[model samples]
Every structure is written in structure tokens, then in C-alpha cells.
Target: MATPDLRELYLSLVCLITLVLILVGGVQVVRHGLKLLLPDPPPPVFAPPPEPADSTAMLKPPRSYEQAWQQTERLRLQRQAIRGLLVNLVLLVLAGLIYRAHWRRLQIMRRT
Candidate 1:
């Protein structure tokens, strides 16, 4: 078996992340496209106003809540993703510069 090239692996990971960004952006585009194409659904045919539950029934808060750990996990993931994107962009720009620099070097070498 042959050893894998780390540089190639890194590039593939960056490409995958870029693909995910494109997919997310594409989904938003399609969602807006659908909204543009279709008329909004008419409000519920039977307009029933929200009713206050009887006190006799168990009174519970209607607000939704997330556990502290869950929120922390979401924040962690968001931080990780943002960091990954920033790093990937920097890598891409750096790679472009390296390629251009090397290409120019090669041209100079050939001219010598």
C-alpha cells in the first residue's frame, strides 16, 4: 500500500467545506426561488384565535428552552465552523500566491 499525500488530503477537506457552503447558499436560493414562484398559502381557512388554557389544567410556560450544555455545544460548533472557514480561506489565498510565485520562478529559471 502507498502512503497518502497529506497536502492532497488537506486540499480535499477544503474543497468539501467549500462544497458545503455552496450547498447551503444554493438551498437558500432555491427557497427564495420557490417563494417567488408560488403564491403564499392562504391563512388557515378556519380562523381560530389562540385560546387561553383553563387554570384548572396544568399551567406550563409556553416558551421553548434549550439546556445550557446544548447551547454551549451549538456555540462551540459555530465557533469551530467560523474558524475553519477563515483558515480555509487563508489557505486558499496562500496556496494561490505560492502557485503564482513558483510559476514565475519557473519562468525565470527557464529564461536563465
Candidate 2:
């Protein structure tokens, strides 16, 4: 019925948090791999561009908006890829930190 010591509680909490984070990171890596492997559903195509407000406007035909939209989509996809890579990189660092801590501890105990 005794309460757990603060240090033990904190350690357990940290271990639990690290385990959950590793699980989530692993899932995301798997999902990204699947996205690469499986063909994604086709992006819904947009309708043809509308005519400009000016009745006599014919010099440029006002297609700038649609072009901008296409550019935006490209940028968004690139951002997503970058974000995914960053998340994986962080996960790698955390995993290495956890492994190094355990390894050094083992080395110390062996010397003792």
C-alpha cells in the first residue's frame, strides 16, 4: 500500500512515453512506405478554367489562378515529404540515444 518513490515513478513514465513514441514513429514509417508502394487514388481533377470577368479580355485569358493552384499543390506535397523525413530523422535520433544509454550502462556494470 506504500506510494511509489518519485524517482521510480518518473523513470517509469519516461520509459512508457519513449515506448509509445517509438511505436507511433514505426507506424508512420510503415505508412509512408506503403504510400510509396501502393498506387494512391487519383486526385480528383478540377473543372476547366472559367472565363475572365472582362467581356473583351483575350490578351492573357486569365489562367493565372489555376496555374497558381497547381503550383500550390506541388509545394504542399513537397512540404509533406520533407516533414515525413524530418519526423523519421528525429525518431532515429531518439532511438540511438536510448540505445547508447543502455549500452554505456552495460559497459559500466561489466567493468564493476
Q: In each prediction, how many residue pairs overlap at the backbone (N, C-alpha, C within less than 3 A)?
A: 0, 0
> Candidate 1 residues 1-112, lDDT tens each?
5454665455555555655655555555455445445534332232234457665233433323234445565566555555555555555555555555555554554455
What TM-score should be assigned to candidate 2?
A: 0.51
Residue 73, model 1, lDDT = 57
What digit string (tens of lDDT, one per residue) describes model 2 on residues 11-102? Answer: 55565666677778777877766554553443444554557777445544356765776667666665675578578768966975775565
The C-alpha lDDT values of all candidates are 0.50, 0.62
Off by over 4 Å in 2: 1-3, 39-42, 48-79, 95-112
Error of 1 at 87 (Å): 1.1
Task: Candidate 1: give the clashing pairs.
Answer: none
Q: Best by lDDT, which number?
A: 2
As for candidate 2, its clashing pairs are none
| Candidate 2 overall lDDT versus native | 0.62
Model 2 alpha-carbon miss at residue 25, Å: 0.6
Q: What residue runs in model 1 are displaced by over 4 Å at the alpha carbon?
A: 1-66
Q: Write down the TM-score of every candidate.
A: 0.39, 0.51
- The root-mean-square deviation over C-alpha atoms between each candidate and the true structure, in angstroms, is 11.9, 6.0
